[model samples]
Target: MASNLTIGQRIAWYRRRRGLSQEVLAGLVGRTTDWLSKVENDRISLDRLSVIKSIANALDVSLGDLLAEPSLFEWSDDRGSHSIPALRAALTDYRQLSPMAVRIGQEEPPSSAGLASEIAEVWKAYQSSLYTKVVERLPVLLAEAHHAERFSHGDARHAALGVLGQVYHAAASILTKVGEADLAWIAAERGLAYAQESRSQVVTVSLLRSVTHALLANGRYDAAIQLTSDAAALLDDDLPKATPDLLSVYGTLFLAGSMAAARAEDRATTRAFLAEAQESATRLGTDANHAWTAFGPTNVAIHRVATAIELGDIQVAIDIGPKLDTSALPIERRVRHALAVAHALSLWNRTDEALATLLDAEKMAPEQVRYHYLGRQLVLSWIRRQKGKPSFQLTDLARRLRIV
Candidate 1:
């Protein structure tokens, strides 16, 4: 019975199932009964992750149960139909359990240089928001990275391990983007393990950001914050001599921390994390994408807007979001920032502008606009609110996103 319902309906269903009235559930989540009634009636959209998570908690339900997100692969093009399954196979490959088996190198292991080149290509595709390309390439890359790590010797082996770590990091990132939170957690942990094995402090710390993201996806915001704080602290002693890449990684951790803190609704901690990230960005003094971190003043500014949106400061986000230029950032970052701006506009009841912003983002990264929860929820909310016939633009966007 719950399988064919919208999130709001499912919430109402679970509320009734738990023998709880609207008032009781509303009080549990710190919302007025009127607000809950709007939610249950689908008059209001639970678009914010933090708010949705709180409601899920109050209902004693998993976030996934509440959201019922479809697998990214299920709706992807034919070329990517098997990507998720292949990636799962690679991640859970039995050969990884037997170092002896993996070291045999059934095929010649890619050289450390070759692995690095391959990783760079995948990262470029990912940052460009070419998610389909990234998904298709990663399964093979994961298999080869493991082979390289197992087959090499000494320095080469360590380099291979670092490459392996990076491969896992990419897997984790894409998994999270696609709503495969559990798989993302596994990939991130595996990345950290390989990074530590290589004894690369910078890679290890950067991979912690991946783990933190995976944790955030699973609604473990406090854990994400603590992990980010500890990881950022580890970089302090080396700051003076740190390479740009290391500093990028360091600053990125704080940005991630800011996000986690914001999601947790800890305004003070969020501000502190943002301040630390800003300091690191100031020291760097320019926008850069070292270590694929994309950390710098502009990126920090983007996070500031994002965190404000998360903290329910729509006015603040609305004020700063539209004026900023994000051309220097990667397409992925640019599109995500656009989504945040659209969210702020939507919340402010500037529906036309929000719709325009989202359409512009779709032009740049249709895949992101399609798969991102914020974008999907925003469109859903707009469609739900339409009276009689919906606007052509809204209907077209909804069809493109396959959300209608």
Candidate 2:
């Protein structure tokens, strides 16, 4: 019986089958012969998905045939001597779970022997979570995926790349939540490059959208708009089906454009963009997939209210705000909560009620609340400046809302 071969041995086997020495193979693949020698000797590591595919193709063998070993044990100098066992154990724990359990645990299981299908499934689940913003569990999932990539061969390497791209995108998103926009952009760019290498158009679009969102959040709205336009142009003339999954992204981009117009105080442009978003929502039809249902009619209503508030159309904001559904919104989306508070204050001219709403939102998500609540604090200060004494109830609320 043939002994189980490590990835390095498989590469050596393929190289020998082609009747090419390490020097010749290295030249064909555009690498120094020493690099190929180290790979064959298991002295170096390979993680890039594209390189693995190139080797598999050159050897005229399926990736699965090249990576048939069920287990891989290896040494790595860069990760510290102890890191390999820890990583292997982690991968082992990951592989033991059923797919449903993996979902519940918020992790992607190590891919089974076949590569492409498994990676695609994991990518689908990851995309679904993005719409609902339940991505807190992504980092651990991604770390395991990186471990799996180290030993992948053939189609497995492609699968690993697909998984790595998802991991990068998820990390970028988490970084954005923690206020690290620069790192978020870098991660996003890396993910996009990998997705392109994978030849996955859907993943490419998703990464571009992430990049646009990060740019918009960082106040680089012009760049954000340009990126979105370029991505849209790259898509074929055919539009993707109006699934809620796709609509959430499409709707969010429209909302971002409206927000940009509002920031510029371009009332007409803002209204047009909001109208476009509402139209997109209407086109989505009423299919309620939890993953896609996040950006529903309520989101459109909130955008309208926000545009009105920004345009100084207080009456319009008041009229539309009460009709908007708040049930779908997570308590952590504090900017939306602030919009609710602003609308209520305008409608009743009741500082007390508005103060209460703001206080409640601050309690729910204090960190997120600060972004728009700072403006609310300024408004309260102005009201107090004009009045001989601040509303005592409002003052109490302000005390609670202050970060320090």
Candidate 3:
């Protein structure tokens, strides 16, 4: 019976099976009965990682159990699909290789400048909604960058190592989206280690952002916020000398910290960090994709949509939805922003529009929009609400996502 329930309904079932009343379970998790009731009714989304973990612990279930669907592709009960395991193996194998193995002089080395161009191309591909391509290319890119770093010296070695860190950071992000939180953590840690080796604050911040995201995915909201906050504190004395890139990185951390706070239900902290980030965005004077983060005024607006939805401010999210321009963002950013709008539209009883918005996201990034757990969950909830037949669009999406 629990296996047939939505995540919210499953929570209620688990609480009842565990012989805990809503009030008792709420008290156990330090939440009010109203919050618990809303969650059980699916009136509010259980999006916060901390909130999900609390429910899991109080119900004595694992996170995987809480999120898993009978339709296997809808969610992973383990480390997701084979893609994640393969990605993990690649990272592990790369890390374990002997230094001598990477110094391959048998083939002509690509020019450092050309290798750098290829790295940019990879980032561009990722931003353009080529996640599968990015994942397919990463292992080789990482190996080549490692080999390049092993044979180079001075600025060449430094640049090569920086590229290595960037590739690892991208790997962490891709892994997280594919539902491999554990592997994503390792990728992020490795990226951070490589960043430290490069001794670049910009590189460090980029990797740190990925680490924070992986932490969020793992329900370590407090630690994620603390890590980003501590890093932000380190930049205080150097604030006057901060370049646009540094300021953008500072803004990126604040944005991430804001998300962590929102996940923890700390609205005050969320707003405070958002304000700080807005100041930095203002300094940049435009919505630039600094350090490939897309952190700027327009980017903040997209986050505002997400934050509003997370905080159950459906009206707020709806109000800000139309102001976003799909053109101002990369394809991935557009998908993210569109998903937030879809969430808002879904909650506002605009189910048709919500489904349309989701379809738009699918058109942009077919694979990502198809496999994401939240979108599938939301559609399933809607399907359950249908009096007779589900709409064809929703049905097709569910079929594609394997949630039927």
Full candidate order by lDDT, most accurate first: 1, 3, 2
Model 3 error, position 189 (Å): 0.8
Candidate 1, residues 1-404, lDDT tens digits: the string is 42235678778988999999999999999999999999888888665678988998998877766765744554455674587878888889888757666443277888999989999999999999888788899999988888888779999999999999999999999988887888899999999999999988878987999999999888889999999878877777899888898888988998988898998999999999999889889999999999998889999999999999889888889889999999999999999999999989998889999999999999999988887767777887788887878899999998887776
Cα misplacement distance, residue 281 of candidate 2 (Å): 1.4
Q: RMSD (Cα, Å) of candidate 1?
A: 2.1
Q: lDDT by residue for model 3 over 227-323, one digit each (tens)?
A: 8789888889977788888889889888888888887778888898889889989988988887887878988887777887777777888998856
Indicate whether candidate 1 or candidate 3 has the larger lDDT: 1
User: Candidate 2 — which residues are off by over 4 angstroms?
Assistant: 1-109, 112-142, 149-163, 198-201, 240-242, 266-269, 287-293, 332-340, 343-350, 363-367, 370-402
Instruction: TM-score each candidate.
Output: 0.95, 0.55, 0.86
TM-score of 2: 0.55
